[model samples]
Target chain A: MSAQGETPVSRRLSKIKHIVIICSGKGGVGKSSVSVQVALSLYASSPNARVGILDVDLTGPSIPRMLGLDGHPVHQSTDGWVPVYADGGEARLACMSVAFLLKRKDDSVIWRGPKKNAMIRQFLSDVRWGELDYLIIDTPPGTSDEHISLIEHLSPVHSRLSGIVVTTPQAVALLDAMKCVSFTRTVSLPLLGVIENMSGYACPCCGEISNVFSTGGGESMAKRGSIPFLGTLPIDTELVTLLDAAAETEQEDDKPIEDVEHEGFRLLRRYKATSSAKLFGPIVENILSRLSGFTAQ
Target chain B: MIAIQQPLDVPANAPDHCPGTESDLAGKVDACEGCPNQDTCASGQAKSAAQDPTMIPMINERLAGVKRKILVLSGKGGVGKSTFTSQLGWALAADEDVQTGIMDIDICGPSIPTILGISNESIHSSSSGWSPIYVQPNLSAISIGFLLPSQASAVIWRGPKKNGIISQFLRDVDWGDLDWMLVDTPPGTSDEHLSVVRYLKDTVGVDGAVLITTPQEVALQDVRKEIDFCRKVGIPILGLVENMSGFVCPGCKTESQIFKPSTGGAKRLAEEVGIELLGTVPLDPRIGKSADYGVSFLDEYPDSPASQAYLDIIDRLRGILGDK
Candidate 1:
């Protein structure tokens, strides 16, 4: 915070059209996958919607791995830290993560709350987002520390800032996810909706939806709260393999083809074949429609 | 307002050879340089040593009856930390004579109450201290969720407040005589993890920590950090439990790779990190359903593959602990 009533974060983020955060109170509910797919969907919806993802889960940063940008480094410039573009130099999907700061992929970031908060504050204040249409913040599982810091810094963009709660069908996951919805309301951040991830497991051999984890927990929570249900996402083995495979191998050795590039989503070319991209494409379009209404208001 | 505080067992950011905060050389040692708690540990230790040196002794006295203390930890959230804790409690309590206690310190989202099937139970003050809700005659547990007015509400607390509540839980709870005590911690290596090790390390002493993770590079990546966190704080690593290892299709009985283990999952991770791979529990939908319903999946579906796997892991765990 500065004496002039504007933070460096707000000033740096001023160029972004809308910032939506993807959060779930529970971990392993696919927060990272959803964030990545959402970024791809937004960029795929329109070429002009430049996107950036800020991975804030300091202890367990999967965004770098999810986007196949694990070994990528964040370059510091005269303005601040320059985010690594998803592809080569000209791509639109920019990203900043603590994973880039580590020398090894498996290195641990062992810091207490105050230290984690300091890094988070620096992430918020120092990253140069350039001109992003949407900057989706990927948060860890909690309503403490990083979350409080994020809401504090982004308060200036509260109206343009929206929150999306992700959850699964299990009672335990939904039990905590319901609190996530209430948190957005309590903080006065506009609620985009609730997404039920891992709703069911589609068997690879049989091609049958197994109801493995059951379904509809997120929708019921959304219905009870009168919030829009963003639709359920089944456990996509296809999406899992696409991202997981890309994560295992080194990216950036392949030559770029002209024109059909999916900005920010390095793996979106194959991700489109996954059921997640197909399901998320329309969900994002719906969100953008509602977002347009929000901005218009 | 600063009376006296419990010094950290080993602050998270402490150097390799950093002495425990209770040490007279806590803030004075070379390893304590750049430790965030150096200032507080220095002045607080000096004040407590002068004014009241009984704090550690009192905490030690409070936790005296617990025979063994273990922490269930995972660096990533929602990786079945609470589920494993609850099931471990049930498995230990399966014996008619063994008494077990579970302490859930995941303040922001205390799902232990829900997972233990005690979501409706509330903590009560007893003559001795706070009475933990007994789910069974042998199994008892406590969580901040029990203190909440409703399960639907979020505990929007900051770190200091979380630490305060954790301290109070330790000081006020009468765990009584128990054969086993399992503390389920929230994900990440931060305030709660440090606080648990801080209060319990020098007092009753943590026997070890059971690391849990799904078979994925991302989850494995975090578990490695957890391994480091335990090593840094001097907590012995019991082993790692791989939950959601692979999903076995109920229809075809064919196991599918829900989370592809591109980096060889926890098996390779454990081998690489030089820790024991206790066991991998395959994904069973009934396990999640049971946890949500707050019942013992081990009891309901003992014949199932997941249950047997859990039993085998528990047997290995008992053997490992028994020899020690």
Candidate 2:
């Protein structure tokens, strides 16, 4: 464990092997969900691999809610602020977010540029992530202060800093997603690939895959931008319901329930079987293969 | 300050290309062939000289024409700040006596132009200043969207540049004698929000802010901070607007909670903050289509449940503004 106060970020994050930032130029394209799923999928694929999910979407932190860690406070030790750990069955995933620091789950963070930068810096330097194989950072929409600050802060510490841009298969979303790709290029960050989320919706009753927004936009974007096309995630309402149920159940932790009996727990199990979860398998594999290739270089 | 050079008069038989009318100034044709000041204009140095100084007095002078200023803000993205602003503008303009103008300060994602059906309208610069494009008889707007050469062109600007443009939007745009001026801000409480609140406060004094949020706990959580921001900055919050509260199924008209309020919803949030919950607008598919097609849902579907909710919200806003 690294000592917390006044320690340099590079030394603090030196143990982390790889850092992947999930970002989108446009909001509401399921960036946070993709980040969470990727982190979980990485953990699922390699049970021994240490995964840490950092929700740096300071103003709008949704990773905590999605992972059922909302209202959990970060603990401070002699090492640093300890992140909350979520049990992913055989493997455990550590989580840290600004949402944990707020008094209420509904409290807003009305911070300016300097404040946001400072918060991101503190999250990078202060969190006691320990030695981890992967650190997935979820950022807010656009290439704003958070994006620049995170990249600038991590470039000195982590050489294997890569980015995964997320976008829906819609022209309007792709228009912004292209900017995200361009932003990664301008920053000189290595692009792992692009994930087209909410590409289609599988009707539970009809058993038909309906094109919700549109499909193949992200694949074409990846080809045009010369980045790897990761995969497409379908819009799964069950996943949303599972996330909401988890958040509610976790907030009501006073009443302990058996893991097998918890509704949220059951819903999460069902969520892991959904098409979106299956989509994450290929995306995670692509990201790992790309990272290995980079390491070889 | 640079001295203003008087332009030479056009000859009696010269072509009808004099830069006198609004159309001539707005059009692409250059009519400065024989003018004495053409040299300075050709080099674009005079344009800088004519730029409005970003001072409090200058902004106040420009805002003096507007009777009331309302800022629409949302802490969470995709919560429909631009959609609500456009609808509010249309609803306010529905009254023939009321004049409204929307100033979109969302530099990166300025959806005002597209939402208000004025995406093709060009902003014309005159000797006075830049004029906002009038989308309707009673409604006009100014946005960073209009400044872009194409819709696909992104405004990849940093904080200071965005602040500069927002200040310029308020100080330079010719929004004359508006009964109401609605300032639509980007999601989050960052540079844009601070700039709009600070500028409005120092210049014309903002009436209040209408905070928008969805019913989900994820959105309500951030919106709470927005309210705290208004209080901390000494700006009164008019009320809270719960958008996309429920989804009315078109088949049976049964309202369902699409994005359920895991944290007790906005009504509870407003109670905790001791503010008014203006109204809750159900999720309507047409609303999305309207925004995409640059049409006002309120005008196109006046009988929509969402439109009625907006009308009620507007009524509450009017009550807060003491307009009714």
Candidate 3:
């Protein structure tokens, strides 16, 4: 094994106690939504606990829009690049994404592997994530350049790093999701467990849970693979409204979601009222329990 | 400050902190000492440099049998790229005389096999090249899923491995005499995108790309980037299709915007970008069910409005590519 010495990346990431990679081999399975909700849940669990979300889904970054931190930009400090906070500046949750550096938010990244790798390295080495209790890295949906870059940079922090695999409930999703589990196994990244996001649809009007995508496929995959199946997160339209309310209430009478001040509390507060948020509570507890096993040397 | 180039292409085996393959000092740099792709990089296989001009004619000759190819792309995932490819395969192959194929280049998530009802089929490569799994008498398909030892096994490959397979899929796959081929890509303009576009664009011309998006602004935002990617690469835009436009309750018969288009959705985006709005398919739960079952959604739900919309769009696409 390569010596796990203090490399530049590990030196920077050392302050972050727990590093969780939220990933899947499949796309459109609500990885971003899960990452945001998990961050919100962590912050809500302990408002003072510092959390950071590094959105490495470079070509298709959705974290800013989901968090309603659309117009915020990263600033260069003397020490390093300062991340934008999801809440206010003093808030515990910080975020760094390629989306923050875009000249125009909607411009196509159009970069290939080497460029993406350099950016990922810079993100790991340059972001000044001061003393985070937890830092969740949301990844793109492939096993290519970005994933490789992340694995290389985070290797030294292996003991502190694990992965939370997200998947929808359909067989096609499960088939692809199994590969993600396999990748984690190959890389020897500790498993935090699997999350079955988009498991079902929570109909707002009817107040019933429908198996729109399906249910329990994640559990079966987990059982077969012998990894922990954290839990199922239904398709909550209410939460969708919160994440995308910028568009929903864009032209309406009320102030748009992103424009409102005290942004973090409002969004996190409303997110707490969501069914997904309610379910994520136990999931976080499971994560916390698993992390507690690691001695903080 | 590290430079991020336009359409940068680097092999997966390149060493860490390696100057990009497109760099003038590519393989000559210190990092290249033991890299596997060092010699290739030094020889200028780097795409943007376009040093080896023979690559185009070679790929063109390899793909000469393919008449017209279309790529189904969305910068966002789970928006039904594979599902659309399956339906398009079935629709195009409806005429038995027409030889149609769907190339699943999503690599890590090759959902086409499962969606096309061939999840159990493994590929067979011969001296001629790899033989595609026949989905129908006329419709054939290829995917890394088929090449996997098991459907659940992960490829876990980086850019170089992906690029190599994509090159083989285009140059070596024996897709004999395909009339219409639909290339399904994963969400992003990364390795697979650059490789496929370069191979096809430099060779036989691509028909264009059919962009997919949901009604929400978040999804549409990515579609704009996908369009930009296409424009930058010089791939023509066929049109845009708004999927999951709305959901109709089986009981109330009322339409609801499940993924509401806050800023007019794809319709507004099409108008703003001066691209045609091919069609919009409302959210039908059965579409997911059909894809999960590995059956043709258009065939199973022919009477449904979504099916009708799909047929209409297929007709329009054929019309656009008909003269060729």
**For all candidates listed, what's the TM-score of chain B alone?**
0.83, 0.84, 0.83
Model 1 TM-score, 2 decimals:
0.90
**lDDT string, candidate 3, A1-297, tens digits:** 243678878889888888989999898888898999888788777647899999999999988888877757899999899998866645588999998998887789988788999999999999999899999999999777788778877878877888899999898888889888887877778888999987766455664556767788999899999999899888776777678753222234255445664445566767777777878989999888888776443
Estimate, for each residue in B1-324, the C-alpha lDDT of model 3 and write its tens digit.
Answer: 011122234443356778866578887889888987688678766533333466567567778988889999999998888888898899888888899989999998999888988989987878787899998889999998887767766676667657767876887678889888899999988889998998887779888999999877678878989998999999999999988888776655667666778778898999999999999988888888898888999889889999999989888898887742
Higher-DockQ candidate among 1 and 3? 1
Q: Which pairs of residues collide in candidate 2?
A: A106-B221, A108-B225
Cα lDDT of model 2 by residue, A185-253, tens digit: 766778899888876654454455556466788999899878898888776766666665565545555
Report the C-alpha displacement of residue B23, candidate 3, in angstroms.
23
Q: lDDT of candidate 2 vs native?
A: 0.76
lDDT of 1 by residue, A215-293 (tens): 9889999999898888889998778766666654335535553443433334766777777787887788888988898
- Candidate 2 lDDT, B1-324, residue by residue in tens: 000011112222234665421122422346656665555445543334223354678889998989989999877777778889999999999998899999998776677887887888778889889999998888999997787766655455556556767887887888888999999987777888888888888778998899999887767767877887788789889999998787655555556665678778999999988999999998776786687678889989998888999999999999988988
Model 1 chain A weakest 10-residue run by lDDT: A257-266
Ranking by TM-score: 1, 3, 2
Against the reference, the lDDT scores of all candidates come to: 0.82, 0.76, 0.82
Model 1: DockQ score:
0.40
lDDT rank order: 3, 1, 2
